[model samples]
Target: MAITSAGIGSGLDINSLVTQLVAAEAQAPTARLDRRQSDLQLRLSAYGQLKSSLSSLSSSLGNLKNFSTFRSYTATSSDSDVFTASSSGKVSKASYDVNVTALAKNHQLSTDPTLAGAQFTDVTDTLSTGTLTFKFGTTTYDSGTDVYTGFVQNPERAAATVTITDSSLEGVRNAINEADIGVTASLIFDGTNYRLSVSSDDTGADNSLEITVADDDGFTNDGSGLSLLSFNGTDNDLLQNEAGVNAGLTLNGIAITSSSNTVASAIDGVSLNLKTLGSASLNVDTDKTKVKTAITAFVASYNAFIGAVNQLTAYNPDTNTAGELNGDGVTRSITSNIQRLLSNPVGVLGSDFTILAEAGITTNPADGRLVINDTTLDKQLNDNFDKFITLFSAYGETTDIYTNFVSSTDDTTVGNYAVNITTLASRGDLVGSAAANLTITGGSNDVITLDIDGVSASVTLSAGTYTAAELVTELKTKINDNTDFSNAGISVDVTESAGVLSLVSRSYGSSSLVDITGGNGKTDLVGAAATSTAGVDVAGTIGGIAATGKGQLLTGTGVTSGLIVEITGATLGDRGSIDFKRGYAEQLGNYVDSLLASDGFFESSTSSLKGRLEDIADERTALADRLNLIETRLRSQFGALDALIAQLQNTSSFLQQQLSALPQIGGSNSR
Candidate 1:
């Protein structure tokens, strides 16, 4: 190792001087880089604030984009404990008196105690070897006759059966459980004996069970066998624990019956869950408080966003300190646009209800936070609820071309569509045309089975000779006469025009099919020209892009996205469009989205600032490298000078010693 010292030979601190010189050389450059780095880092932080505030503002605008959000209402019941109700904004504000007469009950039946006593020990023990089938049906009561009708078979679900062997009853129960059928089985003890019981999982009169037990051992359940578990009157062996019954209630003096206590479809958008037999007055109304709360949240989020922006772009006169984005054009533009939007009134809605100010929402002059006038808002909501809803939602004006136009959030641009319909939808029809002189005849034994919708009904004709008009009248009367078809909304229109008779379905979809089957030999009687035509779908294009048409409705996606206009009239070529306009919330949301999206200007600006920061970092690293080189060169020069000075000192010391020795001898003569 080489030794280093200061002022050892030349009486000067050369090492210290070299260090001071190197530091002086590095100071200005390092200071400059540091200042640049600090400025870049501060600007990056400011960009982060911008991103966060914009994101927060964007997130808060989600629910406000829908007008339904403002139209939302809450339902209240006078007896909340007995019944609870909820609304989905579609229901009108009305007071309805509801009487919960009875709740639905499940049907349950248990086997006879005498039969249970015949069972062996252990649940694994089986009593017979056969299969037990279960089916569900309903029973209606004839009040006039005072008799209950036979259980009507409903063939929607096939009967579920459980096969039994000489095995444990527990195994049988497990098998039934694993089947995941509608019914559940278990062993019950009735004080003296344990009986096998089964129950229907669903409640209602239509969910009553019919259990049929069949055994290969010839054990017939003639009122005494163990294979009988049913609610039929003849089954005296089994005991009925409970009878399935429908929930009966009255709404505003109107008799209402439901299969279950949870009745949702009975009302347009309200779910009524009956709890007990009681009366409750349900007052459905517009929940203005909830809408106000949502509006308040939006205002708060927006204020927070603007607050962050102001802080990032503020300038302090005393400290002569300006924020990072104070002079940025984008920041100035963003501020101006938001302020303008917030100040302006929404003019689409009428003059009376245009803008937030008219709706009782006003901005604070100091901070731009929205403040609501509760009383005024309540009055507006009560006076004109629909108009208030239309304020935040785009309502397209119907034109001669299109009738029902629905605008959504994706409907950003306002324009019309030149619709050209190449084909219009046609309903399926059966033409029963015969020879000009043929007369339709019907016998008493002749049965006409008509299949409409997905249900079929048969009617035995009365013996008569009928004309084409009479036959059409009879068919229409019979189809509408059936209760099932009427309840299923099935209608058949039979027309006789120009000596030709035809039957057409009222529905226009592909699922709307009508078949006339089982006429026996009546095919020639009705004159074999009976035929069906396929229903055609409305096909065309909208806004130069191919549109999807189903029946009378035409919808477009992509270029014409959110375009849903129903074609009610037959305009073959160039059907006009409904003009769509954007609402206030939608416009604001779109602007915010543009500012914060992945390819947004905020991201671009942040990237540019970070790039400059990277450049500053590189300059700082280079300054450090130069300082190292300068220190190395200064140490080398000082080291050489120290060596030369040390050599001179040594030479001088030797000469002094020689001179001292010679001076003692030359003191008297010559030195």
Candidate 2:
């Protein structure tokens, strides 16, 4: 068929054509390899997507499983009859008569009376006398000798002049308030004149103020206008005269108290309904219905998980193929573990409780779907709720099935991760050493060591090695004997198990170092016999003080002082303490309850879902990067092949031209 190569002018040459075809055939295997790699990558990407989806579904199922139901009630009350209910949703017909009595109030008068129009010329002068005082509810200010300067001045006294020289009037006010006297002082501005007035810091008759004047000529006891008996009740009461005034109330059959006003107070062992009277008949079965709702929710969540797992494994007619997790080991393992966990019975009150077929949930062999028998479940919930709780919840001494389902460590493939954090560097306690030149008096005659910064001093006593308890006892004796050590606020304690000697300062607030070393020439037993060779040679000021005074005690700054640790580094890689500045954990728990009551739990769950979506977005970015790289490689390889094909075509054409131009050997013979 190719014999007409000589007739077709400038046609392709046979040999060049054959060579080009053979080169093209050799590249076919490489193309196949590229396609196979692409397929593998696609499969891996599908697997990743499936895994991510499953994880998200699992998280959602976990939340559904944790869903809970709470009961709330309203109350109604009458003056004669009090009603209480064990449960709400139904009107309690039973009623009882009740009687309430108000509590009595206690009152008292102030002891240190101040006459009206009494003025202070100088608060510091009065304070210097070592007795400037006030009273509260007949209780005299006992700390009169420790009084600082005050700022209160009588406005009624025209000739009385008060001039505060050292501190502001506010400072004086703070001092008086801190003293907790019955009278509160305030500054009054009348145009150009500034006057200070003292008022009773209490309510009712209990917090009346009486002023008496002494030595101050301008002060007067005026009985007529704004008399000395003037007792104005303002601010907090100095005397708490109201005794248990804030009592809870449960009126009629309803709780109408100032506090929780719930049905719990309406009747003994009963909660009351405090609602507007109405003819609508309340259904008592509503409470039972709520229990039914909870059961339904639990079943729904359990079934949903089962359905999801089944979808991930079983084949379907619509999809015409097995699920994403078909034949997957992880999926199978999870299913098997969950099934075993649910089926296993837990010991409780002399009986084994389980949540499998007995809970009205039966597994279908075909699709692994759980079918719920509602009738059976309702009966079980109604008859044996406590037992049901025991089976599901970790109530009493029984282990909970729910907790085990989520947190059990038996399955390692998927478990919650716990992270631990620790502070990097912390210093051990400092110790002191004994030297022959330095007199070591006070405390026991045992070897002691001291640490300054990173340096250590070891002073061995003449006695043999002693236990930590013995060392502590000896150290205490030495401390008691030496007045300087005791007065210097230094304390010594030894830990036997760790063989650690600790030196603590009594003055914890002070930032100073205690000097353990005595003077150079002191001839104590420690000073004469102590040798520096065995202990750390602290030459300069020992414990922040230079060696001074012969036979006198060496005094220095106190020891419990150092540079405060300022945390500065990379973002703290640990969860810090969440200390409530003004509240407690119980308050926080109540806050959480309030949040949950206000639908904040749903918001939090949605936020968590949004976070998961962001993770999916990150995965998509990674997939995009991989896709780009694959495309780049594929383009480069394909382009090189196209260029080779073009070159082959050109070579074939050139060979054809050369053959056409070749001399014809048998043309005449053919003619």
Determine the C-alpha RMSD for candidate 2 after optimal superposition of all C-alphas. 21.3
Model 1, which residues run further than 4 Å from truth?
A: 1-11, 114-126, 140-149, 166-172, 223-226, 230-236, 318-324, 347-352, 388-390, 393-411, 415-553, 556-561, 565-579, 647-667
> What is residue 359's positional error in candidate 2, in angstroms?
3.5
lDDT of 1: 0.69
Please report, in order, the local distance difference test score of every candidate based on alpha carbons: 0.69, 0.36
Clashes of each: 7, 42
Write the residue-wise lDDT of candidate 1 on 1-671 in tens digits: 96657667677787679779988998888788778888878878887888788788777776666656765878889998779999893677788999999999987767665554334345554555566666676755433442444775443333466776544556656666677778888986656555677788888888777766676667646543335444453333455677788899888999888778888877778889899999999988887776666666777888898888778788999999888888878878987897786666555445445687777888788865677887887788778765555455564545673456654446535555656677776676777656222243455335667777567887654334445555555556666767878888888787676545676878775656666766652363344666766466777777667878777777776667767767766668667655555555666778889988889888888889888988887887887788889888877777777778898999999999888777465467763
TM-score of 1: 0.75
